[model samples]
Target: MAKLHIAMYPWYSFGHMIPYVHLANELAARGHRISIFVSKKAHSKLQSHNLHPHLITFITITIPKVDGLPEGTETGHDVPMELNHLLCDAMLLTRQQVEEILTADKPNFVFHDLAFWIPQVTKKLGIKSVCFLVISATCMASGIKPFREVTDDKPLTEEELTTPPPGYPSATVVLTLDEIMSLLGASDFSGMTKLHEGFTTSMSDCDVLAIRSCTELEGKFCDYIQAHYKKPLLLTGHVLPEESESKLEQRWADWLQGFEPGSVLYCAFGSQYVLEKDQFQELVLGFELTGLPFFIALKPPVGCTNIEEALPEGLEERVKGRGVVHGGWVQQTLFLSHPSVGCFVSHCGFGSMWESLVSDKQIVLVPHLGDQIINTRLLSTDLKVAVEVKREKNRWFSKESLNEAIKSVMDKDSEVAILLKKNHLELREKLIKPGFSSGYVDRFVQSLEELAN
Candidate 1:
């Protein structure tokens, strides 16, 4: 066997980019060469992690300015929801720079995130390409089935929208009307259509499909995807970084130290989700009602400068000593792994889910958008390791609902709490034990090597 040179490109979101970095580092540790293509902004974040210099190299590419996009918007996290489509459109412009790198480097294989056009470029250059899915296997399987089988442009009927996609009989995950409307109404329909087409073409044309999940957790969904796509699929496990000792900020450390062991609730929506004023207030009131110590990191809604302005007046003072609210970055892993943290109230992004799972924390899900809704279903319905907040008719949850859900998870005698605790412990044992994630990465790299040869 010979060492292989690989090229990797991920979508401009941190959720997408960080997982790819985990995979690249794993491959590099196994003595392979990996070149990562990222924007200057993303490259700076990657460099901050201080990745292995010898085996992994990052190439910076300029994101071409689109007319409607804000100046210097290079990634999904930097742009607003309405302008996300323009970001996607801007990525297409990078094809020339990518082509130049491909021509110069001639790596054995290219691993790309859902930028559908990458496969076409690989095909033209006669390089093997793999489609790396950064989402759950259920979301990928469900999302692609319609694009692959349904040709009609007609909108889905109420019944059609709520049912599981064909061929996934065991899957309990289905899109609600609210979820469907959010997707259709959020951005340019044409852009979304193209993105769907990209998924189909990328899966149909790629040499392999790699997902950031394990058979232990999503075996059934993975099997369904393999049968449906009729392509070799690789499970990349969680591709999470190994837990290590790191310095925590003294202010947060001291605050967390004051709480009883495993008694604090940690709340954070990922980088992309912004809370409207009403939602923010409800969450604050809900957490305050729990009467438990909590730490929250939130992104203010558009035009709001900080969390204080977005929160209800006197809310912070009312919850004093019981809650700590920070608007900007908080080291999530440190907080999740802390001795005082018990439950994670999250947006249910895959990255956050992985972190919560490995940290052995009970999850209280408040899914806001996109695949998160599916993730919430999977976590609560399929896995039974978390409980989702009750939503009302309009899909909005009341503060009472949030408070009740948190109490249900935190109550030691409750069946939901006991079951979640049991499962969380089992999952943590599986994830943190040596070689659990690495085994999957090893097999994935071997499969890629075999394909390259």
Candidate 2:
């Protein structure tokens, strides 16, 4: 096979860029020369990951900032008030920078994130641009369909998705008007529509499209998307490497020495997703009410204005020794891999769910917005690996419901819960074994090589 030179353009967010880079590392290990096009901030994080010597040889193309977004305000959640204007400007600017790099370096193919104008730019250069849909393909297929058909205020009627979607065998998980209104209240639905428009165009135009999900988890949905798009759709089945058992166990030992096995509930809502004052308080109360030891990682909602005060009244004092409230980043993949962690209370984000599954932990879904609700449905209904929390009138998770969900996941004799535990562990074992560890990634690289041939 000929030597491959691959270019990867990742969005600034840690979640967006990390997995792409991880894939790059995997490809590089197979003797491909990789070039990563990313923002300066993302480059910094990549450096921090302390990549292996062979991977470090991969080139980086840094996109300059359109405006000075504060140093650490780099991720999607850190969007400035003038986000759209800045983003559109950055796209054009990055296009020039990316073109310059491609002209000089001449990579065999390019990998691009869904964000930015990569598909448009790469096409102009006559390069094969492949898009990696970082989220669940199931949700992408469902969400983008409305954009293709819905032309105006006449949104998707209930009847359309109430039954099994014509293309997919699974029953459609329909959201009610109340749920829609609830999501609209907290989220920027108009902005979301625009985002999907870009996403759909990228997927349609890219030479290949891939997602960071497993076939076992989303097989039917993946097939539906491939059938609908008639494009190469790849699933990398959670491309995560297992940490050394000794190191992982030691880290858990420090935290879980005195705690009972399967007695501590771990609550982390991923890198993005911030909570409003009320929601944060409800979460605090829920963990407290579970009557189990817990560890929580708190992110100061985007601008970091008055986060400490956002807590419930004396809630910190209540859970003192029995719980933790950490901020900034944590070694989350490591934390999840720990033996003492019994259950995960998560935002149902695609990345978080996969990590929870790979770590062999059950989930208590508390979806805030986005495709999270759909992911939650897949977890609860399709995978039967988790139970969803009930919502209040506004469809937000309430303290009472969260408390109940926590108790249910931790319940010892719950037949379904026990079965879920057994299944997730089995799945975890399959993923880490030699033929499976890099199975999906290896296939993708092999396909790229075939294209070159």
Candidate 3:
């Protein structure tokens, strides 16, 4: 296949951009020219991940300020979920920037997510637009359909969302009522279509549809998408993070080394999603109850300036030697590979889900809307590679539920522990098999070439 130039513009959040860069690196490594649209600050953080800098380039785009958005907000990470639509508004305003770049560069393809109107832009320019989703295919399947099929303005209701859409894969588990509610309310930003409609429009408008996932893991979901939408689809595998020459920070390495191998728990939610103070304390209290050495790299609770202020009154002192809580980012990939880190307690974002899947650790997921689809799939009886913390009717979990979920995987003698560990290890081995991810990339590139042809 001839070398192609692919321009990617993922959502402004760090989680979304980082995964795009991972895929960009894979494509660049395959001798393709790649250009990524990013804000200067986001590019600053992503610079180190550009392994093939000679082939990959960054195109700057401006984020227009919306009324509710803070003055300097260039990414969704800077704001609470309630204000994300404002970010989306800002993303839409970059249409001129995107079109000018596309007009100037005349790339073979432009890959996008979050820009639901991207198809409208590419169609006019006669560029092949790929809606390469950063979210799971399952999420796409249930929430989206052909944009032309919708004849009414009514949004998908909670009841409809809780069950798989017609022609969806026969997965035994569907979204819980709470998750469905979260989804319905997530995009409450005025002047925007509902989240489900947005996804439907995105997939419907694209020339080629691709997911940051693999057939081995989500083949049925991918099939459902291709058949349902009648659009050519591609999978980029998990686009696993490239191995880093950087090591874990010295302080964290020393602390983790003191624990027995596979004994400590590492917990992190991605950059977004701040817990309420009560919930943050509940989460820490749960970690404390586990009595296992743990490191928590999460944002401070809402209403607090930092993690230190949000820590429960005595949590630090009680877990003094065994626990540390930090608010800022850390080397998540390197920490996951550490020998002493035995288990992963994740907020279950797509990137984290893939990271956890590729690790040897026991998996425990606490799903927010961001990953409810994939998280449910992993914990379903069909796969059973991980366990989920039980939540109350209001979708809140007690410290005990959190504690037990961790300890369930920690206890070697328990039947559930044995099953989870066995299944997780076997699956991880399969996913990381030599060429598993790269093979997907190869086929994905072929699909792109076919589209261009």
TM-score of every prediction relative to native: 0.93, 0.86, 0.92
Candidate 2 achieves a global lDDT of 0.69
Q: What number of clashing residue pairs does each candidate have, in the order they appear?
A: 0, 0, 0
Give every collision pair in model 1.
none
Superior candidate under TM-score, 1 versus 2: 1
lDDT score for residue 172 of model 2: 44
Record all residue pairs in model 2 with backbone atoms less than 3 Å apart, i.e. clashing. none
* Residue-wise C-alpha lDDT for candidate 1, range 246-357, written one tens digit per residue: 7788999998999899899999999778877787888888898899899889888666898777877897788888798889898899998888999999999899988888
Candidate 2 C-alpha lDDT tens digits along 1-453:
887988887655566677877777677778777777665556666765435556434355544466645444444546632253345345456677777888777677787755446766666777777878777876766653544355468665655433344566466455664444332222344534455556676787887888887777778778888887798877776777556443444544576666877788888888766776667777888888888888888786544565566666797888877887666566777677667788888888777877777776778888876667878887787667788999887667777888888887688788867876776777667656667757887887788877655
lDDT of 3 by residue, 1-453 (tens): 699999999888887898899988888888999999999879888998899999999888878878989999987678766566677778888889988888888889999887888889888888998988888877677665332322358654545446667776756656665565465335442322345565677788898889988877778878988997798888899987668788889988888989999999999988777888998999999999999999999988889998888888877789999998889999998889999998889887888888888989988888876555455565545578888888877687999999998998899999999998888788888899999988989999888887887
TM-score of model 2 relative to the true fold? 0.86
Off by over 4 Å in 1: 148-160, 169-171, 181-185
Give the winner by TM-score: 2 or 3: 3
